[model samples]
Target: MSSPKSGGAGWLVLLALLVLVLAVASVLVGASDVSMLALLGIGGAPADPMASQLLFASRVPRTVALILSGMAMAVAGMIMQMLARNRFVEPSTAGTVESASLGVLAVALFAPELPLFGKMVVSAGFALAGSLLFLAILRRIPQRSSLIVPLVGLVLGGVISAVTTFFAHRHDMLQSLHAWSTGDFSAVLRGRYELLWIGFGLTLLAWHTAHRFTVAGMGRDFSANLGLRHGRMVALGLLIVATVTAVVVVTSGMVPFLGLIVPNLVSLMLGDNVRRAVPWVGLLGAAFVLACDIAGRLLLHPYEVPIGTVVGIVGSALFLFLLLRTRARVG
Candidate 1:
């Protein structure tokens, strides 16, 4: 009963509404209260100079990083899902976060004076290695069951995280690794978050190469039949996912479910067709991050919970509910 034009229009309208909400929420949120009217430049000067500075220096960068990191993770999730042929294969779920965090801890502990870019490069290398390890494991374990794949990934991530935690504890760097592992956005001041630009670039590259990704996802035999080099596509996808995860981990810490949840939501709405889903996945990711960041900023008012905390709590609940509901429907 609905034409494609009508459906697209409806989605656009809903997306526009969400965008407005996120914009208002982002501008009006922080540890210090900034009124909507004042934020829109329709009121007197803010009462506190530090508060204004915090909004400018801290909140803006965090918001920008949130947007960039969310899109990057979401796209990474999509690419991983396509390559692994599993809905739940995300960087966080697949040991990328733990491996990157370990890399960061190594830098913080032993090479403390290394530049930020150097840290990102090291973290990205480890993340790429972790993902490749996961892919190798996937090949070794037959994928006759869909549920087993993500379960293996989750176990692998758990093992890596345990190792990282042990190292952190041994070096008395537990607090530092804990802070980095929790996906906190509170510390993202202007100079601190330029690393997230790497994520932005990776997301853009994903968008540009989306069509090839679709072909690549159709299994090696089918892609080769169509004259596409499956190996090249797989390599490119892993590189994109790894670079984005490293930048996000360094900039915003370890956000768990953004990558896993956003792509599935988009594919549900837009079908399995990767090209149509890519843009919507990005928009949804940005919106979700903005909304969660705003909620974290506002939930405690003067004492904000970290964006990572808010996302983890809310995102885990959402993912579990969706999983149960899907099971129920299937049953």
Candidate 2:
């Protein structure tokens, strides 16, 4: 049998190839008929001008958004896992995405004229704050059981989401909040997606702190022994998670299970080494979202299902299965 390390390396390679294939497939699977033949300059005549424009204008942005958001959420999950020391921790689980959505709702209600960038900043700030709050609560709780930590975060997130829903309802902005909660890439366009560059920057920040995080995850005493500031590294990780959550929420909405799903899969196949794990997490995340987006577009042709719906169905099922499996193991 192959060793786990070799298996992980092989899986990472497979996931990378899958990501590339799915990304190209996504770019080709929209409403307009743009054959792979035409795309390849093979034997087909050029598609209609409007179709071509639609392909470039809408499909490209949507696909790019998928890849970026996927990478961001997956990395955010990895960061959360390292900081919280729990396998189940995710941006959504920790309330970052919901908090950002709440901020977006507030902006829409009070500052209707605010530019998208302005709105994104507000949401990003709140998302980061929410993540920090979860971290703080995490620290306060006794570390007797790592499992309980994520449960606390989930409860806290639920409370915040309830508060957000209450305010949105009172302000008659529930619909707006609802729209943003369900991950949808249909609205992405070129100018609209420039904000995602922030996610790229945050990813770089995560990369820079990767080593510090691995040390921090070893425990406060251990990290301090190594002369690392555990609190600062945790704070930095939360910031990256929050910023990435905000970008994804504003760009493609919630995208359930990405944070929980990608990192776990990567870690399972690759083992717990953060540095080695990150690339596979990102590629698989990107590929998973891209594949889901394509399936959403084609499954209900002429009436595209939202990417969010597809992911929700698949992710929720997978999440529950993972949860049960974990519970069984723990039991």
Superposed model 1: Cα runs more than 4 Å off: 1-10, 13-17, 35-52, 325-331
Give lDDT: candidate 1, residue 256: 87
Per-model TM-score versus the true fold: 0.91, 0.91
lDDT of 2 at 320: 79
Question: What do the candidate models score in CA lDDT, each in turn?
Answer: 0.81, 0.81
lDDT tens readout by residue for model 1, 1-331: 4433333756755775786678667866654666644454455654555556767787677777777777778888999988888887788878888888888988898899999899888898989899999988998985345667777888998999999999889988888888888888887889989878877788888888888888888889999999999999999999888888888888778888888888888777767877777767877888888888788777778777887888888778877876676668767
User: Which pairs of residues collide in candidate 1?
Assistant: none
Over the stretch 210-271, how does candidate 2's per-residue lDDT look in tens digits?
Answer: 88899998899999899999888877887788778877887778887788888887777768
TM-score leader: 2
Model 2: worst 10 consecutive residues (lDDT sum): 38-47
